[model samples]
Target: MSKWNPEQDGTLYRMMQEVVASAGGSVRGVLWYQGCSDCNPDEAPTYMSRFRAMVDRWREDCGSERLPFLTVQLNRYTAPNPTPEADACWGAVREQQRRAAREIPHVAVVPALDCPLSDEIHNSPAGNLLIGERLARAALSEVYGRPVHCRAPEIAAARLTSPDPAAAEPTIEPTIELTFDYVAGYLLHTGSLERVFTAEDDAGLIPVKQCEIVGPRTIKLTLTRAVRGESRLHGAYERNPVAHLPLDSDTYMPLLGFYGFPISGAQYDENR
Candidate 1:
């Protein structure tokens, strides 16, 4: 989600950085599975590049130089569509993910076809839970020495304040102009209770904000700071069937900034 542009871009990276900083950086892994609704066949192939770009951005933003990325292959049991156009191109999408796993470091793919589902066409209810669990397992496997789970949140519209030229720091204050986009479905903000940051051998997390479905396929969230930081950004959002959709190839593309940073923090934050 973004404020100036609804499309996934650098602005969203800034927001995530702020959330991480406030919650304390050096946090646990990042689980991502957006694509189907966002990426089609023609351009889905580029997801390999986008995924690599996203990995670099995550490392920079979270202040972790080697943060791990866990991804999933496209596996929809639609009984094979007859026509070419009707096909969602799950194969090409899967290939993109496979390529990413092979090309990118700290990258691993979680198999989905093996999982049971009622129907791939509209598998919302049980599918959502399955995705979350699979994400958690993959994350744990990659990070090693700890338990991990999806920090799924409400898909909130992106909101931002007018750029304050006078201010030196990036603008984090609330704004009236909110850019609406696909907010997530499962997890909202981290949570009320603060948990120990010792979940991962060397990871930290904290629940900071939450969001819900507000429009056709978007969500909005109000962010708060999570100081203590948990091992997993611990918190469970009220269940929603269609909370997270497969992202587009562009979803992982980084919107670089003036000096090549989508987000600007103190030099101290950089080494933290």
Candidate 2:
């Protein structure tokens, strides 16, 4: 079964059809966890569109328009010393997976970044157990209409806050307040918060001076310098980011990694 091509005649789709025919004509839902192979320069950019098309075809073949799909976000891939381009590809695919979950109907994505990797790219047995529990929770809640908290926390908004609103001059140090959604309770981080959050402008990556949980669902990030132009906030976006990541205090569900969340209130600097 090729990961890049869903149009092949004798592949996973055909095999799935055979299985469904042998058993029953219908299935409860589809659990998809295959995206590592698509993490490449050639495939990563088009991953979301292709995936959406594949889902449409699956629903058509399965005779259900609103068929539920539970997908797993790409986990850590720590082989040898990977190149920068490879890391970018992996992160692109992950961000695309997140987009699919938000854009598509009846589709949900579960985080696997906290899960342990058995090999270079595959999840460990113990990690698989955790993923299985997460998948079951999503299926029960989304498909069976059961009351279960399955959705992982996601970045809602990132806005600039004045360090001192009453100051006469514009403050050089800008504070960004990041708000999250789907959090069951307060947000908590396990390791250094600096490694988990970053900001980027036209120049490059900006150093985060300080990070603190200012509120139940909010995190305040202090930037070293003022934003030059349009800036973006990234969290847990590296190929193999920190193992101890930010998670929900109540459900312990890890927050999903995001790529280019626009930081509002950035000063437009033409001469950067």
Candidate 3:
């Protein structure tokens, strides 16, 4: 959310209702990746309860008893967490994710314990992207009645080495940018026109607003500028937090909700 505090449970409930109508049986599948925000020993016990509630609501919306739902069992690389409560909570959540797939007919869990974690809470772009795409493929293969091709990422845990092997290295900007790519040209936007962004420097493929590839390589996004009544030239969605407040276009942009921190795909990163 824009801000975090207590009452997150209620917030999740409301969010579930909001998403259930559209994502219920109408959609092919649901990909849920969450729970790090509520890690606790007691929280673990309720993870399944909450997840089950959400799934039930989802199925009800479909007017059916089941929907293809895929989940990600998050990583623990960042935090060598010694806290028992936190570990217990995560264990419970992971169990719920895994069990849902096993117990439910159309559910699945994508493994992510080997990936890098952000401060031990969030997942890295490379890992996050793969999780999403894999979920999509799973749904396409199972629910949508299509034979989907899965591009699994080949990633290995890396240990940085220096002259001393223990010394800290200088800071460098991350060159790896993540986004959705297709083998064809031009993406389509569903709603009102947002500004079009042409990459200036190291900026790579950008997916913003509703406009799919309006230009050959250029992406059209509904611009959201922090400064009121100004156009956004910098196309980086996750560039800065304060940068995306006043959106220039409609709020129904599906890709907008996930602008920057995109799910990693296997095309770019391979172990060949």
Highest lDDT scorer = 2
Model 2 C-alpha lDDT per residue in residues 156-226, reported as the tens digit of each score:
89998755657888557888999999998889988778778888898888889989988889998988887
Q: Which residue pairs clash within candidate 2?
A: none
Which candidate comes out best when scored by TM-score? Answer: 2
- Can you give the TM-score per candidate against the true fold? 0.43, 0.92, 0.45
Angstrom error at residue 110, model 3? 0.5
The Cα local distance difference test for each model comes to 0.40, 0.84, 0.42
- What lDDT is reached at residue 1 by model 2? 17
List RMSD in Å for every model shown: 22.0, 2.4, 17.1
lDDT of 3 by residue, 37-75 (tens): 645655656766667766776676656776677776554
Candidate 2's displacement at residue 90, Å, is: 1.9
lDDT of 2 at 103: 97
Give the runs in model 2 whose Cα sits over 4 Å from its true position.
1-5, 8-10, 165-171, 268-272
lDDT at 147 for candidate 1? 43
**Candidate 3 overall lDDT versus native:** 0.42
